[model samples]
Target chain A: MTISSRSGSPGPDAAEETTVIPVVPAQDGADETTTLPPIDVPVLEDEEFEPQADRDATFRPSRAGWAARSAVWLVLAWFVLAFPVNFLSPFTLGVSDVSAASEAAIFAIVGLSLNVLLGYAGQISLGHQAFVGIGAFTSAYVVVDLEMGFWFAVAVASGLGLVQAAILGAVSLRLTGLYFALVTLAFGNFAQQTVFAIPELTGGEGGKEAPRPAMFDSDYSYYFLCLGFLAVVLFLDWRLTRSKAGRALQALRENPRVASSYGINVKAYTLLAFAVSGLFAGLAGALMAHHDEVIVNQKFGFQLALLFVLMTVVGGLRSRSGVVIGSAFFALLHSGHLLSLLEPVTQTIFRFSLVDFITGTIGLPIEFVALVIGPILLLLTITMYPGGIGQQIAPIREWMLGRRFDRHAGKVTEVEVNDVRA
Target chain B: MNLPLYEQLALALTAGVLRGAVYALVALGIVLVFRGSGIFNFAQAEFGTTGLFAAYWALEIKGWGYPTSFLFGMGVAIALGLLTERLVIHPLRDSSRVTLLVGTAGVALAAIGFQFWWFNETLVMSMPKINEAFFMTPWGAVVTVQELITLGVLAVVAVGLALFFRSPSGLAIQAAQQEPVASELVGISVRRVSMLTWGIAAALGGLAGILAGPYLTFSAGFLSFGAVGALLPGFMAAVLAGMRSMPGAVAGGLLVGCIEQLSSLSILDGAVPGAGALVLFVFLLGVLLVRPQGIFVGKVATA
Candidate 1:
């Protein structure tokens, strides 16, 4: 490992430099600087050179090797991104499957929203379902009631999300840590039960129609439309981390007292994070509504909120790719495509339908798989792998980006979000 | 929807006391766990549900007597509490409170999943009440023997906890919570204290579940997220107690219960479909805004 470290870090030179520096300083003052022992010099050199063989072992592929790798990567991207609409699609992705894929994209957006709050801001929101639910209902209302354009409906939904989130932040941001989590939870329940209860807006139990834009009416086009929105959100998230506000939010998360001393407006930046999160959530919700072609209040409940948190944490906090992949995994899990894809192998080997067999044996519902297994994964993520999916995939990501694939490249530092000064 | 104001007030009071007993029971366990662990244990209510499920399986499926099933259920809750402390909480002891809270919630979600797996939604189940006798309150409202039992158990547990705190083991728990390192230096087994705290908290939770189960149908996460869930209300009560006081938690529970039941007034029912939920939301906001610290207790020393 140390020999491999030659290409990545400065271990070899630093050790030699340390030994030589003490000896050279003896010229300044022989009494002040103690000379190193003669025996210690060879031992140090041998220690530095012991792992020498591995320095040449580190993989650095040739031009042709790079070309092959890039070609393979290109085909993989094409298969994932475009093959479903093209004739070469596997698994025979039907129209509903395409719609389900759109849901996956939208879920990625939602997961990113959560990453901004829970990961970047170090704030917990168990009630985030209300944020998305409101966005979906608001967009549905704008298009159905006000006869607005699709973009206009989306804009209005985003605005409402920002406004509501700002109000919530203003009212309860003073409540730090778990108290704030409790407040948001109580508020979420209130919104679901009361604010959403109004028939004019949420349309009660009957639900409301949420039609797709005219240009993106087909399932394939709508899926791309959602993909386009996901790209926009991803771009915004990238810009956020690179901006001054993002840095300030990170500082504040580290220590609000110190951040305040440094002249950062902790409250404003927190509210800003909240608003940004709300905007993305609202946009995702709008896309989800149109993708479903209808919206209902019941779909946005405590379980949905819990699932949002699950996907975000499991995606690897502060990692866009991790969040997206995790969200997509869950979306497929929920849609049952991932399970159905495994049906062939299970049928041939086990000689029975896996889903039906489980349902028959344990009486667990199909959708409950995420609920049952998600928390266990989350527990594992928190305890054994703090960086989650992002950390696991980081080596590959770095290798693709022309960097040495150091095993610890994406290791997450301690994110102790306590009122205690850690 | 047009009942007399006096009748509404009377019914609200009666309903509040009965409902408040269960909330008090749940709140006491929550406060106990928080004091011992310095964490907002979100799985507190789930403990009750676990016990309820255990007892239900024993009674309904195994055809065991009520007393044996109840003890088995309490035993299950204790085991779960021990597993949680050892497996989840102990491993993540250095994690932030947020991470710890999430861990507890994960424990809850896993338990809920197990419940759903073993007892699917297809089975509609309810435990038998302790008694079938009904009594009339002066408010013209009906009172059940089960409710009286719940109230009696709450009283007994509250007094018992007070006395326990004065005992040697209870003092050990307090020392462990306040000065874990110092207590360890002095030869107190802080680890054992943690186990003891969780076990007792879980036992209290088990009592709440067994006593309250007769009032509603049993299912997965029944005590945590069901229609008869006491989780949110229990938290509210703990908050009202400044997250520290024991007796304060009891009083706060009654206050919240009455406030929640007040939504059952005909006027409120006529105006809103889920008046109880709306009232709880508004009242929680009002209390937090007005006091922030607590109504029943002095300033909280820690977060």
Candidate 2:
């Protein structure tokens, strides 16, 4: 496997002319001089010399290639797995499927957005779920009480998210790291209280329902809808990371001071990053509202915020695969059937049902897999394999191919390596 | 709306002072952790709730009764704090502040999970009545025993902390905070000092929780809210003390408490139920903008 390094700076050949000298003590009555050995460097052909070109040729695929090959393969796999479950399985494709998939999509989007903030921007936001909650409530109000169409509700939700992020970004840009986290946390709690107090708008603890579009009444259609949104978001994310703005964002993420010195507008870029992330999160929340047909306060609590953060960290934030893979893994865990699979084993070993085992083991309600699993996974990832599963497997996959998995490099390059150090 | 000016003023002042005391106690716990470890204790409220639950268990489950249960609960809380510091905080000593913060959050979540597991979902602790009645005044204002105790506790803790800081161990802790390597050279154990700090902080938080639990409902959710409530006042206290001065933290806590209470009683009555939080946000913003260091002191570098 060929590994290409990005170019540093080009400079004149000063190394050849430089001579090595050594100093000796005056008491020794001798001036010591040493000559350095000449360096041996490999000379390569023009084809081998062009590393960037070689890397690009090896990895970058045309749009048509992905659409025709990867897209088809993904679709086939989805159908293969889903067909049996939908038709042959005894379980009904009712609220469970819709809830699980929708929640996963929402979390995935939240994770993706956080990748830009925490993963890319090097900023930690403990209150990011506040934006998600805001988006959910906005869409719920629009779709249910205002009787707006689905698209309009989504658009409005995204718009509100943009505004909220803009305000937060402006307020918090001056603060660094922990202070920024604190401010955002306060804002999140404030938002939560505001939502609670405005019972007229949020329906208080009772919650409000968001009617789904006529076309997506069935679980299959709803799942596809969610998948479609996921696909678009993934594409947008891919496109974003490739653009000038994306590179600039990455630069700022690494070192805002350095990026600013290089003529990048730090504040503007930070605000833009926050807004874009909020937009995607809002879209996800809007979809969640429609899919669940309910907007409850409990769904967007602080615990959920922490869960989203944990998912992003566990998913190898900054890589599309990391977010998608982590989302799917957690989604399956959240499903009741997955938990039910352990019932017999738990019953035999612990003399308790799976639910009891889960409750005892995690010290929380068994239903709260997201809470228990998210934090534990976060701790495990940070303490042990901070690069996460996607990162750990990437090298292995490349090694197995022998020719290097260059095609995946572009998506993986954005993953923050420094987080692993922490 | 048409209340006499004198009555309105008295009510605002009394409410501010009472609320301020609660704020101070909560913030004091945060101050202890921050000063000793150089890390913000996001789990302060959770720790407090753990103490509350322990107290609940002693009183309700073990049938240890009120005052004894309270003492038992505090003892349990101290053990939990020591265990947490040893297992979680100590191992993460060299990690980045961000990682430490996130780790504390995990600890907070775990604490909540434990609360959920031990306590029945629907069970609520019947808080002992420490204060039964309020003394009415001609000015249409009343002072309750609960308010008095809350303020009294604040006073005692503040004074006690000041006195402790004057002791040899306190000096050692101060030195440890300033220069751990140097302090170690001078024959101080940084680890022991930190554990002591954690134990004291947790104990303070537990006391606050036991005192406040009767006022607010005790539940698994209480920790999350309680932590948040503690944040602003505690943070303000830390900032005011330059994050280094004990007196500054105390004064800052009292100020935050007063502002929050006054805001809640006056402007926030029916208009904004989140007036306390709003006031805190404003105070934080002001602190950050006008004097990011603090009102009375400069920035004190944490370990």
Candidate topping DockQ: 1
Q: Give the per-residue lDDT digits (tens) of candidate 2, residues A1-422.
A: 11122212111232221211111222233334334332222223332445644453355445665455566565556543464236555444555655576666666777788777876667777777778878878898998789889889989998998888888888778776677777877777666766545776667778878888898887667777777788788888888887877878878766677778989898988888888888887887788777767678767667667766777777876666677778666655655545655566677788887676566764556566655566667666666555565675564334333334443432232234233221
Q: State what share of the real interface contacts each candidate retains.
A: 0.49, 0.28
Candidate 1 segments whose C-alpha is farther than 4 A from its true place: A1-61, A345-353, A360-363, A413-422, B298-303
- Residue A243 error, candidate 1, Å: 1.4
Question: What TM-score does model 2 achieve against the real structure?
Answer: 0.81
B135-198 per-residue lDDT for model 1 (tens digits): 9977689999999999999999999987887788888888888888998998889899999989
Native interface contact recovery, model 1: 0.49
Best by lDDT: 1
Q: Give residue A41's error in model 2 in angstroms.
A: 9.4
Score each candidate by Cα lDDT. Answer: 0.82, 0.69
* Residue-by-residue lDDT tens digits, candidate 2, B108-223: 77777667667756566556647676787666667778778877888898899878877888777778877899999989999999999989988887877777677656677474
